[model samples]
Target: MNLLLVEDDLDLGNGVRIALANQGMDVVWVRRLDDALRTLDGGTFDMVLLDLGLPDGDGLDLLFRLRRDRQILPVLVLSARDALNDRLRSLDDGADDYLVKPFALAELLSRVRALARRSYGFNDETIRMRGLALHEPTRGVIVDGEPVELSRCEFDLLALLLKRTGRVVTRRVMEEQVLPGGQANGSNSLEVHISNLRKKIGQGYIRTVRGIGYVIDVQSLARSTQK
Candidate 1:
């Protein structure tokens, strides 16, 4: 998943980014609320990790603007304010969850997963498409009851494709979700990942749409498995 992390504390931000990246999430970190708002307006993210204490402005005001504009991206606030009013204010401003400073990384990850599940209307950690099952918590994939070993990037790419099965996921979208800040990796990098994934999942499962992008044929995958 693509996540925007708005935090002013350099050490904390770096730690959280590394932790989330290890968990197969692409995160873009910004220190100021203005930068966060700019990124939010210009880019696509599955969720936001916002810190209330920003150098430029309060995170709650940013949340308020997002809510006012009807931006439905899941937001989880992180703050040093552990008081009842502060927590309630953040929730009232449209934060999906709140975490006080000195929180555990595991707890933060759990809350993120829960919010994502609610947004996707899924109650379980495993996402099943056709005969391919992806276990988010464990970072495992099983195809046709057989475990499939994948590189980190390959797993992330496949997860994004499977999540939006049947839809033509543009290269830009895939890049954003698979790579942080949509960094300038060569164009062929994505293709290489797709090729590697195809070798593992079977050739016909993922279709390249020429200049457009790629799509996962979930129905065809099911039929092939049945046959």
Candidate 2:
């Protein structure tokens, strides 16, 4: 998962980023709401871990703007405010979930996973399509009942593709969500990764849509092969 973390607390922010990274998540940390907005505008994130108290302005301001713009990205507010009104207002103002400060990282990760699943129209940790199983909790993939060993990047890339199953995932979207921000490799690099990924999984799993991007259409491909 790719996440945007907006927090000004140095210790807490760094700790959370490290923990999330260790769990196979790509995270971008920004201290202020301005930076958060800038990052949000530029990159695609699976979710946002937002801190209401920010240096430049309140994080709620960002949330409000996102809602006003009709952005449906999942946001989980992390703040020190524990008041009932605060919780109610946050939910009313488009926060998908809320977590108070001094919370366990484990619980936060659970919530993050929950929100991510919801975004993908799934209620479970594992997403399955056409005999391919993506276990989000372990970042594991299984094909034809066999476990497939994948690099972190490969796993993330496959997860993204699986989430969009039959659709053509644009190169720009892949770069933002799969690769590190500002470190998206050249076209040849992504092609090489895709090549290796096909070798591990199956060459029939992915299709390169020249001039557009890549796609995975297992059912469609199966039908075509049968014909």
Candidate 3:
């Protein structure tokens, strides 16, 4: 999942970014409300982890602006304001879920999954295509009723390709979305991950698009499993 994290505190933001990245989420972190808004304007995200207090402006105003402009993505408010009214106000304004500060990361993850199921409608957090099933919460992969062990990068790569079944995912998009950072391409790391992922998932999936990119053909997926 692509997540936008809007936070000002350096320590907390770094910690959260690392934790989210460990879970195979593509996260973009910004400290100020203006930066957050600019990121939102330019990028597409599945969820927003928003801090109610920002350096440039109130995070509530940003939430309001998102709603006023009709951008209907899930927003989970992470605030130190623990009052009932604060929670109520956040929900009323457009936040999908609220978490008071100093909370557990496990709880945050749970809420994130719940919001994902709510927003995207993968009720069980499992995205299935062909003979493969990718479970989000456990990061488990199963092929033809057999479990497939995969490295973190391989699992993330498969999830991206599986989520976009039948659609081409370009190399640039994969690097920007799936790679750890700029230096991740030290020596064709993305291709290595894709090759490993394809091997684990088996044949007849993840076809290369010449010089363009890669895609998992949905029609071929059905045929592969059926045969």
Candidate 4:
């Protein structure tokens, strides 16, 4: 999962970022409301961990802007405002979930996972595609009941592809989400990774769409599994 964390406190932000990354989430942290807005405008994340207080402006203003623009991405407010009215106002203004400061990290991770499942419509943490299974929590992949060894990038790529099975995932989208910090790779690194992934999982499962992108053929996977 990819998450955008908007927080001004350096210590908290760094701690949360490390924790979330350890949980297999790609987290991008920004300290200011303007930076948060800019990150939102450019990147796609599974969820937003927003602090109600930001350096540039109130985080609620950013939330209001997102709602006004009809952005449906899940936003979970993380703030020190522990008033009943604060929580109510946040939900009313379009925040999906609210967590007060000095909370348990485990609880925060649970909430983030819940928001991710809700936003992505994932019924479970494990994704099954025919004989292939990608378990998000374990960071493990299995094919035909056998473990398949894959690098971190390969697993992330396969997980993304499985989530969007049968649809062509655009090159730009893949690069942004699968790459580190949405950085552009000048080399053919993506292709190299994809090629390695195909070699491990079987080339028939993934198909390149010529100039567009790549796709995981669910139907083809089903057919192959049945045979």
Candidate 5:
């Protein structure tokens, strides 16, 4: 998932970014609310982690502005404020969830996954299509009752495809989700990841639409012929 983290503390931001990246999330850290707002205005993000004690302004004001502008992106407040009133205020101001500082990374990840699933209209962590299964929190993919090992990027690629199963995802669309900032990368990186993913899940799992992009047969790929 693509995430924007707005935290003023450099060390905390770096640590959280690294940890989330290790968990297969593309996280962009912005130290100030203005930078965060600018990034939000520029691109789409799956979620936002806003620290209330920002250097420039209160994070609640940013949250309020996002709501005022009718942005539906989920925001989770991460701050040291643990008082009941503070949590209530944050939620009332449009924060989806609140995490206190010195929090466990695992808990944060779990909450993030929950919010992500909620955003996708899924109440569960496991996503199933045909005979394929993906456990998002654990980053596990299983096909035909056997476990499949996938690299971080491969898993992310597969997750993106599965999320939109049955839809033809164009190269540009996939690149936007898979590549950070939608930046250009080494030639054929998408193709390489797709190729490797197909090898693990079987070639028939992802279909290449000539001169267009790829599609996953959400209902019947498991029964199709593999190249």
Candidate 6:
């Protein structure tokens, strides 16, 4: 999952970003609300990890704007305010979940996964499609009942695409989410990873969309093969 982290505290932001990325999730960290808004304007993130206090303004304003604009992306508020009214107001403003400050990273991760599942309409950690079984908790991939080891990038890429199966995923989105520094770094790492994934999981699963991107349209591939 690609996450946009809106926080001002340098230490906490880094810690959260590193922890989330270590768990095979993509993250982009910004310290100010304006930066967060700009990032949101152009980015295709799956969710937002919003801090209630920001350097420029309150994070509640961002949440209010999102709800006002009808952006339904899942948001989990991370705040130091433990007052019942504060939490209630945030939820009422449209946050999917809330996490108080100084919480355990493990618990935060769990909440993130829960929100991800809820927003993506996934009922469990393991996403089963076609013959592939991707177990998120264990970071395990089983193809046709056989375990297939994958690097972190490959695993993240596959999970992102699989979650959106039968739909075209833009190349820009994939590169930013999976590649380093939200870029290709002038290298063909995106293609290389995809090629390696294809070799390991078997072909005909991912198809190049020509000038646009790639897709995992099982039905279309099946139909073309039967022709």
TM-score of each: 0.60, 0.63, 0.59, 0.62, 0.58, 0.61
Q: List residue ranges in candidate 4 displaced over 4 A.
A: 127-171, 175-227
| CA lDDT, candidate 4, residue 151 | 96
lDDT of 6 by residue, 1-227 (tens): 77899989899999999999999888999999999999988767778999998878999999999899876778999999999999999999999999999899999999998886766545457876677888888989998899999999999899888776655688888988787787655677788888899889887678888766787764536434311
lDDT of 5 by residue, 94-142 (tens): 8999999989888998998888676544435787776788898999989
lDDT assessment of candidate 4: 0.82
Model 6 steric clash total: 0
The digit string of per-residue lDDT tens for model 2 on 1-227 reads 67899999999999999999998889999999889989988766667899998888989999999889866678999999999999999999999999999999999989988887766545456877666788988888888899999987788888888766555677878776677562454546677677788778875677888876787774546423311
> Worst ten-residue run, lDDT, model 4?
218-227
**Best by lDDT, which number?**
6
Say which candidate scores most in TM-score: 2
lDDT-wise, the better of 1 and 6 is 6
Question: In lDDT terms, how accurate is model 1?
Answer: 0.81
TM-score preference between candidates 1 and 5, better one: 1
For candidate 2, what is the TM-score?
Answer: 0.63
Q: Which ten residues in a row have the lowest lDDT in candidate 6?
A: 218-227
Q: Mind giving the per-residue lDDT tens digits that candidate 4 earns over 45-144?
A: 6678999888789999989998898766689999999999999999999999999998888999999878766654454578777688888889998888
C-alpha local distance difference test of each model? 0.81, 0.81, 0.82, 0.82, 0.81, 0.84
lDDT of 2: 0.81
Cα deviation of 209, candidate 6, in Å = 16
Q: Which parts of model 6 have CA positions greater than 4 angstroms off?
A: 123-125, 128-227
Model 2, runs deviating above 4 Å = 122-125, 128-170, 175-227
